[model samples]
Target chain A: MRPAKTMKIELKVNGKRERREVPPSRTLLELVREDLGLTGTKAYCHSGICGACTVLLDGAAVSSCSLLAAQADGAEVTTIEGLAADGALHPIQQAFIDHFGFQCGYCTPGMVLLTKALLDEVPEPTREDIVRYMGGNICRCTGYAGILASVEAAAKALSTKD
Target chain B: MRPFEYVRPTTVGEATDFLREHGDDALVVAGGTAAVVMMTLGVLRPDYVVDVGFIPELGPELDGSRSGGAGLRLGALTTVRSIERDPAIAGAYGLLADAASQVANVRVRNRATVGGSVCYGEPQTDLPPALIAMGASATIAASTGVRTVPLAGFFEGPYETVLQAGELLTEITVPLPEPGTFGCHAKFTVGSPENKPVANASVLVRTDEAGRCVEARIVMGAVGPVPVVAEAAAALLAGEVPDAKLIAEVAARAADATDPQDDLRGPVWYKRRIAAVLVERALSCALRKAGNGTR
Candidate 1:
């Protein structure tokens, strides 16, 4: 058998440049929650089926648990912990708070980040667009009504702020 | 996941060279959606995992101009989301776009690639049937040379492909639809559209000036070990202007072509029934598109 190998990867995480030597099996989710101490990115289903591990990679949402940290060698990753700027919660986070987009908070981080990705791409997304784009991030709590309202509120808040 | 050696190759030639030396114990991964999941699940524990995501030539690109004869050339790394949204593909191969749009959710589509999806050879996928119906072919690269194989013959069985250990799929070429050609892809999932289909069907039909069906190809997926090309069903539609009755007959024939194994999604009988229903719906849709030229 070949010897174990580790890869040296340098990537921008939450606007801060960080470098790490990650094993081949070290997933982006592990790098975020374990190594970087950013627990905001949750790991639910280690598989890609659940969106609990969603994060923004180069402004697009992906399941962090579904990819290797080495694969994200030179990319920008935004976890839920990175949403606040200068102690002010991002508008998407505020909307979730106002609309109660989550319950139990297990799926909240992913939901909020995914909403950010959506609003960034489509500033004023229609209801159908919201439903379609956010379909992957599943929330077991609130049966999605609150989540839907939260996404709409976020889109409106961002558009108005723009 | 087990500890393993990680290798990232920047070129296809380099990738194939490494694979030729370590192919027995190495696994090539692009997109990492399927591979990482399998590794996490302990279904695959390779001593070496080759990351092909960085290879510049195996791009995340969709070039319609280079596809000779009005077809489309899709890089192995082209994300499914791109295929779903690209205006050129949407205009010329709407059925392909429709199939791509229904793959998982935006997140998975954003990460999964057309080549990876096809190469994975998982029977219950959305892209293969549409590609097969469209007469697409795959371009594979190896240390020896390169070869193009029809997508219809790319798979061996469930989660099995004809890709050799030292080989990699570079691109897929979707041929131009003959004039007067229209196609439709229909999938029936047990739950949300994001779920893998219990059964799916893709139908492409061409109509002559006299409105007679000159050619047809129907491919059914998820109901067999590999996607089934329903030649008998296509034969029935030949030389006839497809009607509701004739389409129903073709649907039955297509369903008869399936060799579905019972699983959680559906039983053998249920899959066959869904296959027939999807074929009927898809054929009806394609014929409607042909009549109106709305495709």
Candidate 2:
């Protein structure tokens, strides 16, 4: 067997620029959770099926578990941990808390990040849009009523702030 | 996932050369949505992963113009989400757009590429039947240069293609439908929004000024080793004004052409039945779009 080769990748995580040398087999989920020690992004199905590993890569939501760490080189990555500003929670984060969008909290981070990406693209997404956009993220605890309500509330909150 | 060496070649030529040298030990990865997942599942164990995700030639942006009867050329790296959002594609090839939009979910669509999906050669996927119905073709690059293969004859079997070692799919060109032609795609999933279709159908119909069917193409997917073209069903509508009885006949003919396998989706008989239903609905939808009343 050949020795594993590593590549040094520079990524803009949250608001900071960080670099790491990782093997090619390392997924973005592993890089974020293990190397960067940012465990906010949860990994359930290592495959792309479950959205529990969703994160924003260059402002678009993608399954980090399916994304190679090397592919994310020089890209801007945003996780659930990045939603807070200074000491206050972002509107979407606060909306999730107020709406009780999570129960076991396993799928919360991915759900929250997916909501952020959706609202970023469509500020006033309709119910159909919410269902379609958030369809990938599976929340086993809160069913999905609270998650849908939280997304709607976040949209309203963001619009009112503008 | 097993450890593998990674190489990011700058150009298509360089990539193809590297792949040729590595032989079957190397696998080219674009979006990594399929490749990485297969790797994690131990389904594929390659010694080297050629990361072509960043090559400018294979990005999500569609290149080339659709001027003077020219067809739309989509780079192989074009993301499914990008295809879903492109107004030009939606306006001209609505079936392709709808098919792309229906693939998995937003996150997967955001990462999965049109070329990757096609090259993955999964018969159950939503795009192949729609693409085959649209008369699309793919340009592949290899050490020996390039070749374009029609989407109709691209697949050899399930999860397999005619793609030789060191060959990489670079672009997919879809010819513009002829005047008075309308197309529609429909898929029937079990329950979840993200579930793959148990059976899918794509229909393209063109009606003459007298409201008679001039041309018809019916393609059925997810029920066979490849996207099955129901030529006999298409023949039923070739020169006739489609009606309820004729449409039912065509649907049955299409279902008869299916050679399905029993899997977690359903039994072979159930899948064939769903295929017939989808074909009928897709044909009716396309006929309506073509300004023909299937009464």
Candidate 3:
């Protein structure tokens, strides 16, 4: 097989504008992990599921594995590392800590980012809305109840703040 | 992932030139949902990958009306999530949205292109069968030029499409159903939150001025090598009311229409049975929606 060709993209990653020359076949998951050195995004299945690699592409949560690094061109990407205030944690991150949302914490980044996206979209989403929107993120830790509670808690916090 | 030469063509013509120069050794990466993941898994390794994701021509173009029989014109690069949120699509072609929204997850939907799904034509894909029900068409372009192929005619066989070596799927045109029409999509995937549907079905129904059944179509996906039309189910609605018994019979015909095989998802028989049940349930839901409208 031949070596994959590379393409360059101008991405605003973690609030810093950087240029990345990525393989045409390189996934967004790889871009965030390898080139940018932002390993907070983890992909368990490396497919669409397992939510281990979920990140906000253009402010919408999506599976990074399914996207080519070249596709992130001219877009804003916010990974787990980008979700804080100065050095402080984002509220969603705090909700996870407060609700004890992690067991092994392997899926925490993906779940936290995915939840952050949902709460961003619907600050007062109902339980069913939460389930449908958050169904893609899988937690093998069997810590779903805690994750759901954390999202709900974050939602409550956001509503009160609003 | 095996190393391969990646080429980013600035325009569709440049992309086509790359394909024409590379042939089977080349592959077009639209949304990169299937190709990117497969390449990463070593399931596929093509030489000279062409990046078409940035081609402005292939994006979601929503005109306020999915009515007037002129539905939304979806570029091949239109992400599944685009369908999920577009009110025109959700309001007019909601079934497509239902299928599109549920594809993989929001993450994959953000990058998975509509044309990519139809062009890939994987038997396990979720779009073809739904398009079959909606009377959608695929606009395929090649060196000789483009032609509009009805969604049913595009799927040649397993993992193949009528798309030529140099041809790229440019658009997916979802023809709006008539006013006072109802449509629904169902799939038997093992991962849905409500119930893991192993079989997927799309049903569309239109009633006449006198409140008689005028037209209907139910398409089944993931059951066979290609999206098969549920002719028996469609025929049953010629002049009959979409009652429970009739809907059940139509759904049964839809199930029997397919010769599904065993795979990781489920057994062949199981898929067939769900196809029917989902078809019935979907049509019933469509009927209810139709009743609620100002028909």
lDDT of 2 by residue, B135-212 (tens): 999999999989999999999999999898889999888898887888888899987867878999999898998879
| Alpha-carbon DockQ of candidate 1 | 0.58
Interface RMSD to the true structure, each candidate: 2.9, 3.4, 4.2
TM-score for each predicted model, relative to the true structure: 0.96, 0.96, 0.93
What is the DockQ (computed on Cα atoms) for candidate 2? Answer: 0.59
Residue-level lDDT tens digits of model 1 in B86-183: 88888668889878888887778889999889989999899999999999999999999999999999989998898999998999989888888888
Predicted structure 1: lDDT: 0.89
Q: lDDT tens digits, residues A1-162, model 2? A: 222499889999998999999998999999999999999999898888779899999999999999899999999999888989989999998999999999989999999999999999999999999998898889878889999999999999999999
Cα error, candidate 3, residue B264 (Å)? 2.7
**Lowest summed-lDDT stretch of 10 residues in model 2 chain A?**
A1-10
* Minimal lDDT window, size 10, model 1 chain B: B61-70
lDDT of 1 at A10: 98
TM-score of 2: 0.96
**TM-score quality measure for candidate 1:** 0.96
Q: How displaced is residue B222 in candidate 1, in Å? A: 0.7
Can you list the residue pairs that collide in candidate 1?
Answer: none
The local distance difference test score of each candidate is 0.89, 0.89, 0.78
